[model samples]
Target: MQGTVDSTPVVTGHEVAAHEEHQDLRVLGLITFLASEFLMFAGFFAVFLVFRGSHVQWPPEETEVELLLPAVNTLILVSSSWVINLGTKAIKKNDLAGMRKWFGITAAMGAIFLAGQVYEYMNLGYGLKTNLFSNCFYLTTGFHGAHVFIGLVLILGVLWRSRRANHYNDITHTGPEMAEIYWHFVDVVWIVLFSLIYLLTLI
Candidate 1:
């Protein structure tokens, strides 16, 4: 008696290799984009350092940048970076629920940091046109805040997609991976910004 064959197709090694190659290309493209972004920020940093070096008083008399709120925000972002990594680890283990939890925490942290930034702005007792330092300070922090907002949106988009069936698994988690990378970039940029604009200037 001839046995019946299952006839179901399985994913081939070549297909897996091709998918990995595509993912690598996507990551490479993201890195190139981030490099350009870093260059732009570098330009702003140079301008800020030049202004700070030239002026006797870094922030001037009228501008007052407090340390408490920005320090808290920095802590929130730095911790969120770790949380997003946990999400990455979860997805690598094929744990969808775990990934969602960690990413949700990260998004909440990002929201809190943004709210803190807004509160800081309201109480800062200065404006963009106040002086050279104020202008540089606002421009640099505002640009970084915009990136944070974008990162939040990206995270939310990934969460929404994760609700779909089989949208992401251990082998097919590129969306979350890319979002994590962007979030990490945003966090790193803030660390640099905090060190320069807040820590060095205020304390």
Candidate 2:
């Protein structure tokens, strides 16, 4: 007589609860870290508002802020955000190759955006010492650029770890999820900062 057997493993209720608890802890920690980062940016925004209010001419007339390069950079960053999201989806589907390819592309786009910013700075006649607007613009945008760099490092770390360990799937991918959410936060902040510096500065 031949007998057939099912090889699937059953998850116990206790194990499910434990996994949920671990996830909650990681999320709580991430929220706390992000709150601090938000407050730091809020301080910079306050300083900018104060300095702008005190000045009669915000950009001092002589300095020109071109909309072309930054507009292109914004498109690049927004596209990178979508790329990272696709990487996350691939990771969830247990597709390591897909995740790596998408995330690599995301990182490359971010690097390009940063390079564009550098080029803009090099070509611009005004600098950090030019005026209040220059100071605020450089400080805020530079700070956001730093965050983008940090997010890129994190994504690279996730990519490296994913390659090393086979733990990340639809089931257990907290580390990658954290990196992706932080990348999302960085992207959102850039949008707000771009609007404030470029669009609102014209007003």
Candidate 3:
């Protein structure tokens, strides 16, 4: 009689290679999307700069853009970037608990940052129609807030998926990786925007 054969199915090396290649393509797609996003934001920045250049006063003589709240919001976003990285690392290590904790914090921080933005909008002494600077300010920052909201949604989705067994592992974590990339992009773009819109005015 023939010896009993083991019945477990095995993953082929070719299958693994193909999965990696697909993951690479997904990452490349995200990068391309972000490139387009950057161009759009650059256009907004150019418009703001044009308006600033033509006027003797940047935000106009009467309008004052507050700094304290935005500074706090900046800190929140920067911290969230770090937190999300921790989550990405945790998922890579197959530590779902750590990933959940860190990503949860990151999502909370993002929500707080967005709330702060809305509060700032409520308190700003001018309206979008008040002047060109005000218009650019609302447009650019509001666009960024929309991105933050999307990032938060993405994080929550990742967290939900993380609930599944073996959903993400060292070699299978494209979702967390992509979400991390997008969140970092959001943070970096915000840093540039904050410097240009808030810090530059102080000089």
Candidate 4:
């Protein structure tokens, strides 16, 4: 006759349930945080629209925003987003070298975009205090430029850390993921600004 057999693992059912609940909580928290951020940006957009309506032309009849330079900068930003996407994919595949190369290219593109922004600002016929158009143009683009600067710093920090730690992998690359999310947000903001401030002005 055989003795009694114990087939179950040492862990309790409660422990497994707790772990799943914690994961679900974290996901919900992240979604809530993103929603709040969306609302804040929405408020800013509303204010901009109100101010824009006060202008003679949507972007000002007397002063025109140069489409050529902004167009180039927009292309650069879009390319940077692409590079960061590649970098994220490489990190998932555990290809540190590929990640580093792509991130570096992305950083370079960001710098180019920033430089173009400065050139456009300098060449704009009006200063920030000139009129409603100038104020809106500077405020919107300046805010976005500041975000680019911050993103650049973040990318550089990631590059430096990646050299020493193998922290990014298929299952754990949250830093890069968050950075990409922020970068994409910045890109989308610029696209909206370009359409409203540049393209729509022509019509």
TM-score of 2: 0.85
Question: Stretches of candidate 1 above 4 Å error?
Answer: 1-24
Report how far residue 80 has shifted in candidate 3, in Å.
Answer: 1.0
On residues 1-203, what C-alpha lDDT tens digit does candidate 2 reach at each position? 24767644556676775665423478668878998998899899889878778878876787768789999999999988899999989989998888889989988998999999999999888899987788888999999999999998998898788767686887777877788889888988888888877877677
The models' CA-based lDDT, in order, is 0.90, 0.85, 0.91, 0.79
Q: For model 3, name the residue pairs that clash.
A: none
How would you encode candidate 3's per-residue C-alpha lDDT over 77-123 as one tens digit per residue?
A: 99999999999899888888998999999999999999999999999
Please give, for residues 1-203, the per-residue lDDT of candidate 1 as tens digits: 26988755565676775665423477778878998998888899989989889989888878868898788889899999999999989999999999999999999999999999999888988888988988999999999999999999999999999999879899989889999999999998998888888888755
Query: TM-scores for all candidates?
Result: 0.88, 0.85, 0.88, 0.81
lDDT of 1: 0.90
Question: In candidate 2, which residue ranges exceed 4 Å CA deviation?
Answer: 1-24
Residues forming the 10-long window of minimal summed lDDT in candidate 4: 21-30
**RMSD (CA, Å), each prediction:** 8.4, 9.3, 8.2, 6.5
User: Cα deviation of 142 in candidate 3 (Å)?
Assistant: 0.3
Q: Between candidates 1 and 2, which one is better according to lDDT? A: 1
List ranges where model 4 is wrong by over 4 Å: 1-34
